[model samples]
Target: MRWPRQVMSLLVVLALLVGPPVALLTVVGPPITGWPTSGQLRAWVQQPLTEQTLTAALTIGAWLIWLMLAYTVALRVLVRLRSTSALLRRLPLPTPLQATASGMAGAAVFGITTNTAAAAPEHSPQPLAAGTTTLHDDAGPGGGESHTIADADGISVADGWIPRDVAMQVSAAASLVWLRRRRNYRPGLTPGDQPGSDLAPLPRTVASVQAALADNPAPPVAPSSYAITRLHDVLPASGIALTGEGALSVGRGLLVTTLLTTQSRPTASLIISNAALISLLGPAARRLIQRLPLTIVESLDEATHHGHPAERRQHTNGPRQAEDTPGVSGHPAVVILDEKDCDGGDLTHLADLSMGTAIIVLGRWPAGPTWHAASSGHLYDPHDLTVPKLRLCVLDHVAAADLLAVITPGEPALGATAAPVEASEPVRPNPRLPRQSTRYRSHLSAADTPRQRLHLRVLGDPQLLIDGEPLTVRRSAGLQILVYLAAVHPTGADAAQLTDAIWPGLPHHALTGRLYTALSDLRTSIRDACGLHVIDHADDRYRLNPAQLAVDLWHLNAALRHATTAITPSAEVWQAVVDAYPADFAEGRAWPWLDPIRETIRRRIIDVCAASAAAEPDPDRALSLLQAGIRIDPYNAALQERANRLLHVLNDDNTDTGIGSPYRR
Candidate 1:
């Protein structure tokens, strides 16, 4: 390829130099009287050349050679000086000095390629040969970043470097800079651009947390000031309160994340003694910690010692810190302390330090009056553990037992962990009575045992009655969870179903983890108090083990089923069903998940009452029963219709005034 190109270059040069002169002499020279014979022309060609003609041919050849030499020199200079301009840009210099250096570089490049002024007058321009030819050379930088030339009609080549690559690189750098500036600028809400200017957009995790809190029936109160706020609206001013040992274990992580996300100030800190609490909250809670700039201290000592020095200050009278006042910045530091078997003085000292903190003390409320005073909204009391004020949670006793079984290894757990005590009573025998139906009677006397079998009453406020002693399930979620599981018992429920029923709006990832934690808390509380594993699991589904479980709701449901199908249900059976359902299903829960079951059970109760009244021998007894049924469900058209018919019959012995209507109105 190279040889061919060189041959072409030589031919082009020779044609330019020789073709013109031959053309002029042969075609345009003075015309002869007649055309010369071939012998004559050959003789003329053979004759010696004249000095003028020889000079003209030599001069033309010399110009062609000079042009070729100039082209070769220009190409070589461009190749050798490829990196010189780039190197000059990198040197450190003042702006003015750098500009001067750049100008000098340009002058030097032009000086190398152009003929000197002194040599300009030595040669004059020659008329180029006829016809157009274009040439280009790509011999420069290794990359596509190279110089190119476009020569047309044999015109002289353009001078100086036209750096295509360097210009593109500069434009790209400018575009990146503009994009970076645009990305960093954000709009603010306040004209002054203060700390809360934009009021930080609420994180999506808040929705999951909100859903988790809603699992309980108790209403959470957000302060008037926070009514319009994002995350704060879902949070209570008093923070979340957990009473039972099980509830504390389950609700701690959820509470921590809630407090962190909805903190009054962006820079609030989270201080707790339990690292396991964070682990229990699951990946979603952990992710919340990452998104918020809150710091978590595992120990109070760390909070005191490792906290920002500026946060702690000394006053002559006492140590005055911002934490002394609750809601100082409209939010308190979330502090969870484990006080089981802890020293009283240490508890008091920590309490004093945590005055402004949303303190959740996980342990039995101290024995005496002074310690009892410690059991405020912030304190977690085993005896008085009630439904958490802010959030809803649901757990069944059996499922709770399984959960407790899982977290037992982490005993005394982070949030609601209690020290396990030795069972003082001896084991007792539970006698089996003759069964009247498929399901056995709920009552069976315990012959002295270390622990009593649990009796859960979910008809009203769910209560775990052991040995005639009713245990308080302070957490609303705790009771709700038990009720939901019982409502869907025997067949059991998968995690997704339970999550939807309990914490309905939680993100899927967070829902499962929260559900497990809640379940574990239930199991732990039951086990710690009653020493029973009431809940069982198989194939990722949770159900109450009938062998080890006894729920009043179950017994009530059984009685209701038997009464509806029995050929002649005795007054005793109907009475038993009525007694079992002392209140509506999951009374006070009123959750959307509980509504359907609640209505069904209500209708069934009405059915039993209405049918019982129809079969009564005495009109007064019949009227009383019908009236009670109507009282239970005023909207049940059947009960209302039955009561109306019974009243008409009682009023007139002979006349048939009864009318049937299906609608409630």
Candidate 2:
């Protein structure tokens, strides 16, 4: 099947190039009998519009047009070939594999380009269909009021040309798959043993890393293991010197520092000289560094002294063989030094201190491999001409701060406390209770209600419902945007805030188009389903249109708030609160920003269930409530202990009545 398609494509291209010229020569050329000679052409021009001369003129013009068209096609083909060649050259793979991968990449690009061009006309602005209303406003970014559907289509086309990022992501995903297979095949290799084998492509942005982690959700590798940090592609794990000047070098250094410290648990014992820390990492990164597990010393001498006792002893006594000195605490000690504070002598002395330690110098080091960092985050090795230049990950102060904020743990959430429950006490039931209201009623209602209602369910799998019918969101990112907006409801979020929360670590400018496209798609989907606008944008912030949309999370929180503050907390109200929580907030989704919220909500519901169980007067009913609480969180020790105690009480009562206990130990 593949061969047939390939053959047919080749034939079509060949025919296009040759068919018109051949046809002209075979059919039209006989009458003209070849081109006119120089004298004949002058005579024909002087003759003034004879039929024969006009015929000759038309034939020449047609031939010239064909030549120009063919040249243009050839030029485009050449460009595509050159780009493909560059891509192949950059890949760090065997020649055969490189060829195969490059061919696949080329085919994919061609197919995508063809499909996009074909689909362009289909996406062009069409007349409003029956019963459909215009959804988008004419307001433009320049504050103009004359935007048109054609302008939107033009934006889509212009943005379509730069799907290079998508291709890069696809290539990186393939590399990840290969790395996984390699690891599976060679299961015996420890994380530290095969450093070179860890040559998988690294994500270019922090947002990408977060998405990958959320999708996989694996535990961090242990400190004793040699964890590899990504720098665009892969950084050599054996270690190399980084030499550059100004902000670019500093940004790369900060990126490396953050990844090494936080990407895995206890990957290495990191030591940075105080001089390097102050000069290189600015205020934001320094604040983050303070919270990380690393040591900062005044000088390289202090760094060597801070090593393990065995290493210190070895350094004081004499220079042992390289293999004799293990690293600090069985983990490799990574020492970061600045050329300003460190000289050739310091490098020599540190090398003798420990063999397992990796030394990363911030400037030139003649004795070791050195990479020059450029302002654009590309690495160049003058000494190693065989390796191609590669881009490395670089993070500025703002980006680094955002990354730290996301990874760093904060204070314990409210209601997360493990309060003890008294099993012996039986709370008396309230004498009076208030009437129960409808569970899913919207508090925020407008005078002119729309024909349909929009409901967002985040308790379990995120789902959007319109008039009780499920709506399918084609893009995962679009659904995520909606969910995030609902989570931070009425307050809303600006472009920067939204980008940071949804696509963390990426520059807002870089993803501006993507954000706009997703928003447009979301608005279109909502409008198509029920001719009503569900999102409102104002003051550079986007929020759900409160009058039309309702979230289950809002109702759940309201119930909890009432339960906590009530004087004689109604049992029915507490039960309603318990029943409202079908699952954890955004259950089964692991967006990093949603974690704290999810935990807080889960803990609050657990507390409410336990409190409700304590207030029940009947033993059987109280036991049932505790069982329900346990089902929500099996690891809650207080809930577990209370349930066990209640079961014992029930068993004792049954035994006294000479009845067999249904619940046996």
Candidate 3:
């Protein structure tokens, strides 16, 4: 089969190139050819053209035209092959595989079919339609998963797989899409009337997502909903089932259910069977479930009684009172069940419970639409012919933990700690040079001094301030680059490192122009506001100009360094470190690269708070310090234990007196 197709493709190419020229030669190159010689040309032109002469001339003209058309066709085909080859070269694949795929693509373009069957059925969970395009993920380059995309149009090429950073970008883009849709939807607006209806497809790249966000800022939504909405689009009044035994599928289902519940207005609630929660959500269910807006019951019967309390209250108040109840029908109550938990269970009562309630089942259901999720991150909706496939967003355990940590609301700021203490390193007097003349000193100061220092704040909400006045950078990438430079100040990052950080998974060469533009914008913003060149570029590396910028993170690190090295750790130094932590580093921004740095900064500050509390002499002040640390991280076991012990001691002291203890639990 393969040999026949290959042979046919070669024959087609040969026909296009050789067939026309050969036909022209056969008609004009032989002895029977009636073409006039150069010597007879003048005499033939002078004589009136005969019918035979005209016929010969027309025949020659037709053959020439045919040859030119053949050449054009061959040129276009060659151009297509060349472009396809270039695209294949850009893919992150082994040389041999890339070459094989390139050849396959060329053959496909020429109407040569090598093999139509989907290869590696073991990796693909769902059966792909006969002519549908599928991206197969085998053990990719560097032993990671790689995707090879093949379409029904006979275009097969290796498209690179998604990495963690790209995954986060995709998630963020999905959330933005969801938010935009939600914001633009009105009571009677049709799909065409909705805002962003004519917009391009959802952005799959980091740069595109950033650009989209800049153009239309994503409206804020519940943090849990924000995370879950990334997984899939949840229909408000539809029943959907996810059928797959894979962890990714199960997790996606759970997250989608959680998202629906969180989006429920007034007070969100969920009725998930106990078995489903324990078996499907696994060991960490208890901890995570506590934070989610849901309720666990033994069975569906108990769920019925617990569901829609607000609706029940309305019915009791009066028939007319139902109209006044907010969020009664605005958000659908969600019920999630596992196949094992709902074996032979009756779901008919679900309809009787409430209108617009969404039901999500983890496994096969006898009713409603079901989607199958593959381990390769493809979600297949066999029932929907129009849109049969989608890239399913999945969060692994670590990513889920990161999202939860980010969304967990920090306690309100305890009144400011002691004023920030300057680093204890004695300020060395300026080197005593020969004293300048008064006139020279005045001239030098007037020529070189900056009006105000540029302050770069990355801790808490990222902000750029000049003399304490906030400055807004319109370009998100520009601000991100500035923050990155501040984080890695002095040493700086080269172009490659910067590009990888700012636009992860994108080609560095392709992004060079955009990177230059962002860098320029950042420089212009700083220069225009403070008349200072804050970003320094040298030896192809970019860094913040130390003389022109003051970074809060730098100050925090300085205080921490001094506090750690002191002979007797000073409480004041530790307090300075605690005071310096306004919030988590780059809080509210979910840049994937910033996660590790944010966590590191957070843990360091928590340690400092604990150290400060330990160094305090007074019990009251010690408790206060511990509380401050607790406010920073409520889930920190050490801080909670310390605070509990201190509280107990104070409670005992007060109990010994006639007065009662206000601190008693």
Top model number, TM-score: 2
Q: What is the TM-score of each candidate against the true structure?
A: 0.34, 0.51, 0.44
Each candidate: RMSD to true structure? 36.3, 20.2, 21.5
**Count of backbone clashes, every candidate in sequence:** 26, 1, 0
| Worst-scoring 10-residue span by lDDT in model 1 | 153-162
**What is the per-residue lDDT of model 1 for residues 438-495, given as tens digits with 9 covering 90 to 100?**
2222233455334566776767876778776886554445555677676654445688
Q: How many backbone clashes does candidate 2 have?
A: 1
Cα lDDT for residue 614, model 1? Answer: 73
In angstroms, give how far residue 230 of model 2 lies from its true place.
11
Q: Model 3: what TM-score?
A: 0.44
Q: CA lDDT of each candidate?
A: 0.45, 0.56, 0.56
Which parts of model 3 have CA positions greater than 4 angstroms off?
1-451, 488-490, 504-510, 657-664
Task: Give me the displacement of residue 158 in model 3, in angstroms.
Answer: 13
Clashes of 3: 0
